[model samples]
Target: MTVKYLICGAGPTGLGAANRLMELGENSFLVLEREAYAGGLSASFTDANGFTWDVGGHVLFSHYPYFDALLADLLGDDVLTHQRVSRVRIAGGWVPYPFQNNIRHLPPEERWECVRELLPGRRPEITPANFREWFEVVFGKGIARLFMAPYNFKVWATPPELMDFRWIGERVSVVGLEQVLKNIILARDDVAWGPNNTFHFPLHGGTGEIFRRLAARLGDRVRYGDGLARLDAEKRRATTQSGEVIEYETLLSTMPLDLMVTDVLSEAPNAVREAAKSLAHNSVHVCGVGVAGLRPDPTCWMYFPEADCPFYRVTNFHNYSPNNVARPGEQMGFMAEVSSSPHKPVDKAAVMKHTVQGLVNTTLMRPGEAEKAVTAWQMDVEHGYPVPTLGRDAALAVIQPWLASHAVFSRGRFGGWKYEVGNMDHSVMQGVEWAERMLLGKPETTYGA
Candidate 1:
C-alpha cells in the first residue's frame, strides 16, 4: 500500500498526529498499531477479578489549549475534576507533597537540620553541573540528603551525577530558603506545587478512556495489530510483522528513538547507532492491589523515599474514580510504581510480594488488609522514563539529524528522548506540532523547540 503519511504506533503521539492530519483535510495518512488495542502505555486493563489498572500512575493535566479543548470534546461529562492530594513518607511520618516546601511537618530535629544548612554558606561554592549538585546547591545538604538524592535515585534508577538538571523545568518544585522558612514558621502547608495540582480524570475506565473514545473517532484510518518491523528508509518502505510492505512519502515514528535507530531501521550509520547506545532509560513495574473495605486516606498518591517501601510512589487508584474498583466505595485499590535499570535491578518475580508488604510497611495498608486483597494486577513497561543523562542532548543531536535526513520524524516521550516535555500533554502535542510542521510548514514547538 502507498500513503502520503505513515505513522507507527497508535499511542498518544501517533493518534494526535493522525487526528490533526485528518482535521487538516488530509486523508492520505494511516496509523499502524502493534497491539490489537490502542492507548499504548495509557491503556487500562481489567484483571480476572474485575479491578481496572493502568500501566502506571497517570493523571490528566494540560499545557496546551488544543489538548484542553480536545479533551473537553472527547470526554465531556465522562470526566472528573480533581484537586491533587499527595504526600511523601519521610523521617517515619507523613510530610505533605513538595517535601522541601513543607519541612515544618517534619520532626523537630530534622526540621532544624534542613533550616540550619540553608541559613548561610554551608552549600558548595562551585557551580553546579548535574542534578545532584543542582539540588544540593538550591536546597542545601539536609533537604537534598533527606529527599532529593534518595527519591530521585528511586524514580530514575540512575545516579543524579549522571543526569543533566535542565529537565527540572516545572516537574520539580523549586523553593528558596526564605519561602521554606516562611512556610515552616507560619505553619502553612504548601500542597499545590505543580501544574497537576488541579487535574482531570475519566469518570470511568481509568485514564485510558479518553484514548479509547479517541480511537473510535479515527475509525479505520488506524490499522491495529500491525506495526513496523523493519524500515527501508531510503526506499521509503516499511515491512510489518504480518509480512505486508507499505510505501510512504513521510514517516512519523512513535517508537523509542534507540530502537528506531538501531533495531527497526536496521541500516543506520555507526555514529547514530553509537549515539543511541548512550541514551538511557528506566523500566517501570506497576503493581495494583485491590482490597475489600474503604481506605480512609484521601491522598491521590504518596511518595516513598526510604528503604521500607519497594515502590517509589503509590496511588489511591480508587480515589481517582470509584469506578476503578469493582464495588466502588466498598473496595480500595493501591497502584504502586517501581522503577528499574541496570543500576538498580529488581527481582520481577518478587515485585507483587514486595509491593504488598511495602504497602503495609508504609502504612498504606494494614497487615490484615493484605489478606483482604481481592485482586492483584501488575504490568512491567520496558521503557518507562526517558533518562536525561549528561550525554542525552548530545546523543539526540546525532540521532535526530540522521532521522531528519531520511524523512523519518520521531516525536513522543521515547521518540523525542526528552523528559522535560514527555508528559501525556506534551507527548500528544509533539504529534500535533509534527503534523503542523509537515502540512503547514510550521516549525515544531513542543519537541523541536
Candidate 2:
C-alpha cells in the first residue's frame, strides 16, 4: 500500500517536504496553504504602481549544502549572489556593523568611556544568567550599554535578561575579546563574520519566487487559499476553513505552534499551551514607497539600531532587482520595514506619512525630491519576527514532543518558534529534512541536530 501523507501549510517547509517526497519517487502527498499565495510570510505583494514589498525584509542566506544544491537546482543561473555590506545606525553615526568589533570609530572621549568600562580591573564578575548577560560578557558593559541593550529591547520588545542564549551560535556573530581590544586601539573594522557574509538573491523575482517555483513544480498537488481551521489529532484529521476534512496517515504542520496545541489537541496540554502563551512575537509593517526616477543608494539593506528612525531596517528593494518595481526610467522604489505591536494600534496613515518623512530625515530621500519623484506608496503588515524569550525553551520542550508523538511535525518561523532557524533557507531545509525523517526515516537536523 502506498503511504498517504498530508502536509499542512504550503509555506517553504511544507513545499520542501513535498518537493523532496516527489524527488524520491514517493509522490503520495498533498499540500494545503491557507493563504492565496505559497510563500507564507516570505510572500511579496505588488502595488498598483508595481512596487513590490516582501512581508518583511527577507534575504536569501543559506547555511546548509543541501540548501545551496536545492536552490541551484531550482533557479540555476537565475540567482544573483551578492556580498553582504551592512552597518549599524547608532547615536547619529553609521557605526561599522558588529559594533563591538569597531569601537575605535567612536570619538576619543566616548571611546575612553567605553574602554574605561571594559578595563580588566574595572570589569565586574557577574554570572550572566540571560541573553543580556551573555551579550555583555562578549561585548562588555561599554558596547552593550550603548547599543546592544536598547536596540535589542526595541527589536525583541523585551529585556534580554528574559531570553535564553542557547540559540546564539552562528546566528549572531560575537567579537573576539582580543580583537575587540586590538580594534579599539588600532580602530579597525571587521566584517568577516555574520551568516550573510556572502548571500544570494533571485535575479528576476522576489524570495517568494522560490516558493512559487516549488509550488509550480508540485502542480496540482499543492492547494492554496485553504486555511486550516481546526484539527482532530486523535482521528489524524484536520478541517479546513472551507469545511473540508483532510485525513492522513501522517500530518506535517508548518502552522503556528499555539494554533496546533490549542485548536487541534483535545484539552490541549495545559503546560504545552501555556508555554506557547509565554512566547511573544512582533508584527512587521513593510512599506513600499515608489518614485518615478533613478534608484536610491546602491546598498542592499541598511540597519537602524538608532531611535531616530522608526524602521529597524530599510532594504533598497529596487537594488535587489530593477525588475522588482516599475520599468527602468519609469521609476523604482524602496522598502521600509517598521516593527509594530498588537498591544498598540498601528496608525496606518501615520505609518505612511512618517515613513515618507523618515526617508527625508535619514537622507534616504532628498528634500522636495520625494514629492516630485514619488508616484505611489503601499504598505503590508505580516506577523513577522518571533521574540525569543526566557520561557521559549521550556515551552518548546513541552509542545514539540507532544506534537511529535501524534505524528504532527510543527516547523517554520512561527511553527517552530525558533528565531535562529527562522530564515527562508532554514525553514525550507526544515521541511526537506522533515520529509526525509518521515519517508526515509532520517534524523531531524533542524531543531535537534
Candidate 3:
C-alpha cells in the first residue's frame, strides 16, 4: 500500500509529527509503531500490585510555549505542577541539587575541600579537551572528584574522557568560586538552579499518559505492532515487520539513527555506517521499588554519586502523584535508574536487589524498611541516554544529511543524536519542526541535519 506520509515509532517525536501534520490539515498519513502501545520510552506501566511506574524519572518541563499549550490540550486539568526538590547523596549526608552550589551543606572539612580546589590557583590552566578535563578546569578537582566525575560516569555509563563537554548547557549547573564561597559562607542552599526547578506530571497516569492521549487522538492513523524493518530510501518505500510494504512521499523516523542507517536502510554508504558506529548509547534499567507504608518525604528525586547504590538516580514516584502508589497516599513507589554499557556493565538480575540496598545505604530508606518492599517491577531499555561522545556531532554531520537527502527525516532523542536537545519537549518539537520543514518549507529550529 502507499501513503502520503509514513512515520516510524509512536513515541513523543513520531506522535508530535503526526499531530502537527493533522493540525496542518494533512490526514493522508499513517504511523507504524513496534510496541503494542504508544509513548515509547516515555510510556508508563502499572504493575501487578497496582503501583504505577514510568520508564525512568521523566518530569515535564518545556522550553517551548508550544509544548506547554500542547500539554494543556492533551492532559488538560489532569496535570500536577511540582517545584523540584532534588538532592545529592554525598559524604554520608544530603546536599541540595546542583551539589556544587550547596557544598555548604557538607561537613566542614568536606566543604573546605570543595572550596580549596576552586581557589585561585587550584584549577588547571590548560584548555579542557574532554568532559573530564572540562569539569576539572571549570569546577576544580575537589568538586569534580566528589560529584561531577563520579555522578556523570554513573549516569552515562561511559568514561568522560570519551565524551564531549559542550552538551553540559543547563543540564550541568556551572558556578564560579566567588558564588560557591558566597553560598558556603552564608550557609545557603541553591536548590532552584535549573529550568526543571518547576515541572509538571500527570496526576493519574505516569508521564506516558500524555502521549497515550495523543496517540488516541490520532486514532486509527497509528498502526501498532508494525515496526519499520526495512527501508529503501531511494525508492521511498518501507517494509514493516508484519510484511506490509508502504510507499510514502515523505518518511519521518523516530527510531534510533544508528539502527535506521545500519539495520533498516538498504545500501547505506560506508561512511554513514561508520558514523553510525561512532554513535554510542547506554542501556537503562528502571527498577520500581514499591513499599507497603508511606513516608512524609517531599523529596522529588535524589542523585547517587556514591558507589553504595547501583542506580545513579532514584525518583520518589509516589510523591509525583499519589495515584502512582497502589493505595494512593498510603503506599510508596520508588523508581531507580541504572545505566549500563560496555565500559560499565551491570548485572541485570542484581539491579533491583542492589537498588533496594542502595536506598538503605543512601539513607533513602529507614532500617528494616527493606521488608516493606512489596513490588520490584523493572524495565530494561536497550537505548537509554544517547552519550554525547567527542565524535557525535561529526558523526551526525555524516549520517543526518544522507538520510534527509533520501526524503527520510530521522528526528528524535536518538534520531537526532543530540543529548543537549534530547529532552521530552525538544524531542516533540524536533518532530513538529520536521513536519513544518516538510510541509511549510520552514527551517527546523529545534534540530538540524
Listed per candidate, the RMSD to the true structure in angstroms reads 0.9, 2.4, 0.9
How many angstroms is residue 88 displaced in model 1 relative to the true structure, after the best TM-score fit? 0.3
lDDT (10s digit) by residue, model 1, range 170-269:
9888888899989987999999889999989999898788788888889998999988999999999999989999999999999999898888995988
Alpha-carbon lDDT of model 3: 0.92
lDDT of 2 by residue, 235-295 (tens): 7877877888878788888888776777756556677778777777776667778876674
Worst 10 residues of 3 by lDDT: 181-190
Q: What is candidate 3's TM-score against the reference?
A: 0.99
lDDT of every model, 2 decimals: 0.92, 0.76, 0.92
Comparing 2 and 3 on lDDT, the stronger one = 3
Clashes of 1: 0
User: What TM-score, over all chains together, does every model reach?
Assistant: 0.99, 0.93, 0.99
Q: Which has the better TM-score: candidate 1, or candidate 2?
A: 1
